[model samples]
Target: MFNIVKKMPKALWIVVLAHGVTDLSAGALLVALPFLKAKFALSYAEVSAIALMQNFTSSVSQPLFGYFSDRSPRPWLMPVGCLLSGVAMVASLLAPHYYLTLLFTAITGLGMAAFHPEAAKTANRLSGKAKGKGVSLFAVGGNGGFAIGSLLLATLLYSNVSTGVLFYILPYALLGIPLIQMTRNLPRPEVKQVGSLKTLRASINWPLLSLLGMVLSRSTVAAGISTFVPLYYVSYLHGSEMYASSLLTVYLATSALGTLFGGAMSDRFGSKRVMLYSILPISILLYLFPIVGDVGAFVVLSCASILLSATFTSSLVLAQKMMPNNVGMASGLTIGLSVGLGAMGVLALGKVADIWGMPVIFTILACLPVVGFVLTLFVEEPEEETVSLVVQVSK
Candidate 1:
């Protein structure tokens, strides 16, 4: 019997925990936003714009952070990123005006952008022989954090906004201390560091570029679905907020499980094969999502969520391997650019949903993975020489 917990590294575990807490804080903020919207008399469009600002900050900053972390001596970038993001989350709670709220949200996004590329790069480096598993474990933290944050914040909101915001501070403070301690004890790897822009440009290998395209397309679908699922359930299915929220929880939780499965499977098989197989099922489920009614939509969405998340893990593992020298840059493009840009699709899909209907918007989203799957055929896996070149440039 395989003892998964025992085999994982302490550092990986710590990173995962930090990732979760950071995500949880972000998620809590997201869930709490509706309350703020009601209190401030903001329109749906206004609320969405605030959310978009957050996504924009995260998307723009990730690559920049990746570029710097690759060359910087500070091994504490990931932990510091987490701490700053947590502080930003708390700051948002203090915002007295809409503009200030948006500013703080953007700051939180910056924090998130800073943590991921550096932390993911570190996780990939530590995984070495089992990079897939390592990335998967790291991803699970984010997924679980999103789930926990939503649930916890929603529960706390029943009392008051202040209470909900205050609840998060304890977790952040507790988690930050250990992360600081762990980072101090860890030794930095010896590698030739690349110049910021030059390294980032050079790290963009053919395989990595193809994978980034895949990430973007898949992200379009993932982001659209996540942002709209709650509204879709409420409007189309006549579901209660609690039930709709539960469905979202199911989606995130299963996605976490999928990350674990996909990561481990990639280690045993190959990243390409795992990615190829997962996309078909994801596409099929996504296509089926709009047509299905009531509880059936939830079931199909759950299946689609798992496949989508699993493919994400596979893509991350493959991209990291392709640019082993610049794992931060690789991680930035895969998670930061791909996922972040994808989240931005919410704006477009929202417009489409406004005009055509939610089903049509989803049907459009369903096609993204098929594009990604086809692109997968053209993407060649990275070779040893390419990885070595990347390593040299990264140094």
Candidate 2:
């Protein structure tokens, strides 16, 4: 393990750490936002709307940023975006009213949106044979951040909200210093000469687009569960706040394990096969979640978490292979658009929960991975490319 870490590039390590810290800050915000809503006397609908704004803004802008990043020379876009996002988060501390808070949160989301395309593009470029491992490692940073943030926020909420808010700034400030050093030493990326979207659309392989759609659908389920599982446990099962939060931690931690496994499997077997096999088990587990009582629910949630997240790296690797010329855009679509748009499913499922109950929502989410499984059939594995001058130089 030490030898393997030694072999990885310094830039990749920096990106991973930076990704983790940024995500940690974001996670802190996610966990604390609910409390903030309660303190402000906001409705559940209003709280959901804030989340919708964050997702909507992030999803729409990501593809555009990704498209431009592919054509641009500025590899520093990642760090700059991170910096702006951190600043935006700091500014959000001053939001005295709910509307102002939403605006600041949206700005923070835009900053996050900006970083992803450039950072993911960099990861794809650096990851040669073990693309899955690389992506998985990056993802683990985000997940770890999320887990830690959730745990810390839950703990702090017992005391004072101001303490949690103040602690959020620490990670971002610490990360900014190292980002400067990493930015200076990085190699310059060559700009691609891809034509307009029409030509690009003509050039796009349909199988790849189908794969994107599968990811989009899968994201709906994943995001819905991630955003609301705690609420379900709390409201439907009459679980304590700590228990609900603990289940969420269990879900996230298991998902991290799944991510690691997915990346490893994709590197060994093909990404498509790994994804295809993982989906059915995940669907089955999710479908079974609400029907089970106490211990059974926890067991099922853990399993679902692992299987669902395991698909993440494989799905991303598949996209990167499909669009070798525009990896930034591809990564953005898979990681950003699919994941971001998937958050909408939370709102949709929330409505379903309101009408029918938690069981129905899980049943609806279960169908998504099956759809992804069917879509996986159409994706063709990328053929080994003849090593062109650009490919050679990129390495």
Candidate 3:
């Protein structure tokens, strides 16, 4: 494990930092919402509109950028994206009218969409044999950035220093210098037709749809737990909202740790095995969550978060390997589509919560993993030789 960590390239580390910057900007929007609402004299529906618009743009545009990245290999998008994301998000706050703020928010999404697929592709290409580890490191950076973004910006605003919003720009400027130098000499996209759609279609492959099913299932359960569990904990279990928030923080932190380890484990034991092992237990623990005592529920939720997140990098790396010819598209679908669809799933789950109850919502979540497990069973292990062949062709 130590050796694997040591083996990652400097370029991959830069990409990881860039990934952090991207998510930091995206997450800052959440913290800015209440302030924006107050400043604009907005209603709850409008505030929700800001979030929904940002998410919709980011989620939907990623694959479009990703598909283009595979053909064009625009490495400059890395630094450019980081800059655009930070500048636009901060600008949204400073915008005078509500419409301008919303437009900046959408552009911020486009910047994030521009960042992820390219960054993920770079991480995987530079990782050498430690591709899983490399992608996981990239993922962990985003997780950390997201967690810190909310806290950092919220602290600044609460401190009554509105100028602190400008502070978010510093990291991008500092990081962008190195990123520009690093991306300058990246390999141009190869024009070979061997890794093209027709040739690759003839090769043996795992079903991409199966992997999609697995990701959707995982993301749905994850989104549900993150969104609804706090309400459940406070309302049904009688914990303080603050305490529930603290526990939710613990869950996010632990899940990031889970992402780091999951990749290393996948590298050792095959991704298919790791995916199967990581997902099945989550179903059991989630089923037990509502039935447990307070401490037990906390423990169960934490463990479930770990196990659920453990599949993130493994699935991502697997998707890249499965479609080496279209690595950017694979990354886009795995990262962007899952998030977009999962948020949609959360909306559906919200309806469930409204119609049934929180407990019923948990019951539905417990069933999702079982569906994911069945999908995993159908995902034939992606062929390493095919992965190598396509990668070589792409280069």
Pick the TM-score winner.
3
Candidate 1 lDDT over 1-395, as tens digits, reads: 14434477788899999899878766776776787798679998888777777778887788778877766645678777887777777677667888888888888889889889888887876676788888999999998887788677777667655556666667778988789887787666755555466656765666667788888888988877777889987987677999787877788667877888888888888889998998877778877776776688779988888888889999998887766656787788888887887877777888898899877877788788888998888777775567676667455
Which residue runs of candidate 2 sit more than 4 Å off their true CA positions?
1-6, 151-167, 189-199, 386-395
Q: What is the Cα root-mean-square deviation between model 3 and the actual structure?
A: 2.3
lDDT of each: 0.79, 0.74, 0.84
lDDT of 2 by residue, 259-336 (tens): 878887888898889988888787888878777776887898888877788788889887777666567787778878
Off by over 4 Å in 3: 187-206, 236-238, 390-395
Top model number, lDDT: 3
Candidate 1: where are CA atoms >4 Å away? 1-3, 160-164, 190-196, 237-243, 292-295, 384-386, 389-395
Deviation in angstroms for 55 in model 1? 1.2
In candidate 2 the C-alpha lDDT for residue 347 amounts to 69
Candidate 3 residues 1-395, lDDT tens each? 46557867788889998898889966687789989999999999899899988888888888777778876577888888889999998899899999999999999989999999889988988887778788889999999899888887787677777587788788899998899999996664443322345433543355677888899999998888888889997887687898788778888889887887888887888788889999999989999988887688779988988888788888998888787777788888889988688878998888888888779998889999999999999887666786666667555
In terms of TM-score, which candidate is stronger, 2 or 3? 3
- Clash count, candidate 3: 0
lDDT value, candidate 3, whole model: 0.84
